[model samples]
Target: MSRYVLERVQLSAQNHPKRHAAVSCAIGGLLVAATSALSVIQRSETVSWPAVIAVAVIGGGAWAAAMAVFVVRLQRRMKPLPPETDPARVRAARRLMRNGELGPDPETNALAVRMAEQLQSIPRWKKFTTTAFLCTTILGVLVTAPAISDGEVGKSVFYGACTLFPLLMLTVGRARLDRHHRNAAEIRRAAEHRTNTEAER
Candidate 1:
C-alpha cells in the first residue's frame, strides 16, 4: 500500500506537468523581481533605470536557466505509470499534490502520518541553518525600522516587506504541516480502534 501511494505521488507530477511548470516559473519570476527591487533599494539616490533593467534581465535569465535544468532533471526522473492503472487513485494523488491532504483511506493516512513524522526529524545542521535564516530576516526588519523614523518611509516599508515575506511563508507552511499531521494522526487512531473492535468479535 505504501509503495502504491509513493508511486501515485510520483505519477502526480506527470499529471499536470505544464501547470506545475507554469506555477514554478511564476514563482521564480516573482523572486527575481523581488531581488531586483532589493538591489535598487540598496543603491544610490540617483537611480539608473538602465542599471535596474540590466539587473532584472540578468536575474530573470538566471532564474529561467535554473528552472529549465530543474524541469529537465525532474522529467528524466519521473517514470510514467501503466495505462491500466486506476484512474481514481491517480486523480486522488493529483489532488493530494494540489492540497497537501490525504484521502479518508486509513492505510494511506497511516503512511502520511509516518511521512510527516520523518519530516519532523530534522538534522541538527538544518535546524541551525533555519534558525540562523529566521534571525537574519528579523534583523533585516529591525535594521530597516529606523529608516521610517528618519522619514524614508518608502525604503523602510519595502525592505521590511521583503524581509517579512520569508518569515510569513515559513509560518504558513509550518501551520499547514501541523494541520496535515494532526489529521493523519487522527485517521490512524480511528483505524486502529476499528481493527481492535473487529478483533474482539
Candidate 2:
C-alpha cells in the first residue's frame, strides 16, 4: 500500500516525467478541498459559495481516491521480477552506456507503450467519474443543509456549472501527462539504441 502510494505520487508530475501522477492527483484534490474551505470561510454574503467550495472539496478527494485505486489495480496486473534476471536485460535497461547486443527490446517496449497509453486513456474516464461523484456528494450534503433550499432553481444551475469543472480539469491534466510520457519514452528508446550500437561495435 505504502509503496503504491509512493509510485502514485511519482507519476503525478508538475514538470518531470518521473513524478507519480497518482500521488500528484491526490495532492491536487486535497489542495482543491483546502481552497474550497478557504473560499467558504472568506465569503461575507450567504451566497452559494459554500456549495461551490464543498463541491470543489468533493471533486478533489474523488480525484485522489480514483488515482489511488488505479495504482493498486495496476500493481496487481504487473508480474514480479525474476530471481535470476538476465544480466544483459539489466545492462540494456539500466545502463545507457553498457548496451551490448541488446537495444530496446521491441516486444517489451511496444507492449509497455500500449499499456501506458491504455492506462493514460482509461484513467481520464476514472478521473471524470470520480469528479462527478465528488460533486454529487457535495451537492447532496449542501441540499440537506438549512441554507440551501430545493425551492431555488438558480442553485441547480450553480451546481451544474461547478460540477462540470473538475472533469474539464481532469481532461486537460491527463492530456498533458500522456504527451510527456510519449516524449520521454521516445528519448529513452533513442538513447538506448545509440548506446546499444556503440557497445556493439
lDDT of 2 by residue, 78-176 (tens): 342332434344333432212212235754443334333333343346556666767765764564342345454554454445555655555675565
TM-score of 2: 0.32
TM-score per candidate, in order?
Answer: 0.52, 0.32
- Across residues 60-179, which tens digit of lDDT does each residue of candidate 1 receive? 767866785666455444444544555455555434433456567754444444443433332225466468669868877776777777888777877788688767756776566566
Model 1: lDDT of residue 81: 50
Residue 145 in candidate 2, Cα distance off native in Å: 20
> Which window of ten consecutive residues has the lowest lDDT sum in model 1?
115-124
RMSD of 2: 11.4
